[model samples]
Target chain A: MKKVQDSSIAGERSVTGEFEILNQYGIHARPAALFVKTASKFSCEILVEKEDTIVSGKSIMGLLTLEGSKGSTLKITARGTDAEEALEALRTLMENKFYED
Target chain B: MNLKKALTKDTISLDIKSSSKEEVIEEMIDILVSAGKIKDRKSALNVVIEREKKMSTGMQNGIAIPHGKTDTVETLVAALGVKSEGIDFDSIDGKPSTIFIMTISPANRTGPHIQFLAEISRLLNDPATRQKVLTAQSKEEVVDTLQL
Candidate 1:
């Protein structure tokens, strides 16, 4: 099994990255806003899906609906002209826990 | 809506020729107006101003995204203003804003609006592309760089 979670398939504009929620409170309030704000800065369509449900990556309200707990693993996918950049941005944010404990 | 679908060739400008925040936004709105993307310029301007009052849309690294969501238009529209000299936009990073993407969308629409915003950010995130946009001599060059 490929332990790496940050790999993209060839020939498609879409890129995918997976990360586990590590923050004590998951993504709430400031973190969600920051996530949405960061996501909003890009031009690609980003999706953050957990389990089988998918949500728009740029909507704070939609992200909040996930109620992603501390251990929930998220599957982030981005498609469009800047899909790779969007995926990297989300990956950094999630890996760093949005820079919050 | 996809940025390419809404961002027409006429909506892009390589030179902003303005420094003030409001003036810059007005210039961008003008692009939308000429493209028939704006039905009410005054109302659309008012909405964008109101949104600024709520929070500064300026992103760091010399980028500002002034967006409005209202009935001023029934669909998503975008305009770009590139200022080589950069303008002080009160950005969170305190950097002069060189790229301003004026986005106007219908308040009732959902999903794609956020994606549009993300796409704009992602575009500027690339240093090479951002540099190309900043140095492009003409609107056509700017559009071509963005398409890259």
Candidate 2:
């Protein structure tokens, strides 16, 4: 039987980690904009994957397409220089619940 | 920041009489002014235009969210206008935008204003809600669709 992959990682420069959405409203326009703005600050290429779907971390539109409700698990990955820093920042944002009430 | 209060019949309009992107924004802001939502029309228009200069507020799927933070507004005031023929909002999708949501938020209360923008995004995302709002014939219908 064929099975689908929930998450995966490859390449030396790439760093990946899983984080759960804790905000009550999840990642809508405002939070997604904040995330994109943060991801754009780092030089590394970032991508966020939900289950098997992958989207550019720097694209506000792409992030919105995920329809990431609360409690959703997101896998974040980054590559290039400062990859570690970029991934850490994003993970921390999810951990901080996007500073939402 | 309250959608129920921010979006009223007086703020929603169907007959947006403007063609160009800049002019359309002028038209939308004028709605807020007439409704007494904006006291200083010139300053409010300038603030909204300044934000537009940085990046076109033209969102995809026939909607454009033009927003700015200024002290002229008491809290958060929103006006929704529909252009049946559509106008070039410089959207990333390269399509004409028919729905314009002009939001003027107070500078000090940005947190609630941001949450309101998120709410607008969620409302427009739903197929049923979007359709109803777009095809709304009366201002009352528009207000109903925006109600949470």
Candidate 3:
């Protein structure tokens, strides 16, 4: 993963991405669990935005509540002390198909 | 959140055949009812089905965790099952799921639900755990592997 320094602020940094859930079955319990597990590893506060709702990335229930389906579009944002690192971690996870194993 | 009290061995089913989402959920409701976990099968199925209508419970990989929160449930409960033949779940990863983890909780109990999700997720994320779960020969093996 490439690390990009924030240009907008002296110290503040953020990473954002729009991920499309490509799995045939949308985000279910297991995947939600995986997503949350990955998100919890970072110090940054992760947020998943779907439609009009925004939820804590660390909460499985919060992610489940979004009811993200196959082909659904989600905007994932992470911001905190390690916002850039957090975002990169999540981006890699998402790009790897949420590490479906 | 006291999963032992909520989870009964009777609530778990082994080698069930379900070609559709409703069939799978109906099987889950049957388990809940037979185990005295829920009084109204129709209502409980409705709650779960309603949630499914909003979005499929199929996750990445070959697993699906269908869940719902309803007044019909007296406490947090879980039902684990396996479909060796795999089912056509609308999974995000486009995979047929061989395992199903169905959960239900009272309408007001959010903490247990969150905790359950986290624990289950953690377990599934482990490659060793996943291999154990996938290779288990019987329901007892699956249950023992989960050890929740």
Candidate that scores best on DockQ: 2
* Cα-based lDDT for every prediction: 0.76, 0.78, 0.73
* Number of colliding residue pairs in model 1: 10
Better of 1 and 2 by DockQ: 2
Can you list the residue pairs that collide in candidate 1? A41-B121, A42-B118, A42-B119, A42-B120, A42-B121, A42-B122, A43-B118, A43-B119, A43-B120, A44-B119
Per-residue lDDT of candidate 3, residues A1-101 (tens digit)? 23333543556566677888776556656567678767877888789889988887886656766767667787887877787777777767666666553
Candidate 3 Cα outliers beyond 4 Å, as residue runs:
A1-101
> What tens digits encode model 1's per-residue C-alpha lDDT throughout A26-92?
7543455578778888898889888786877875545655667677888888877788887778778
What residue runs in model 1 are displaced by over 4 Å at the alpha carbon? A1-101
Tens digits of per-residue lDDT for model 3 on B1-148? 3545555578766667778877888887788778877887777788888888766777755778888888787778888777767788886556787778888889875666756665666566555776777777876776687784
- CAPRI accuracy category, model 3: incorrect
Model 3 RMSD in Å is: 10.4
**Per-residue alpha-carbon lDDT of model 1 for B1-148, expressed as tens digits?**
3878877778888878887998998898888888888989998999899877766777556877788789768778888888989998877657799988888888876445666665665566667888988898887787777782
TM-score of 2: 0.67
TM-score of chain B, candidate 1?
0.94
**Across residues B31-54, which tens digit of lDDT does each residue of candidate 2 receive?**
999999999898889988897876
| Separate clash counts for every candidate | 10, 0, 13
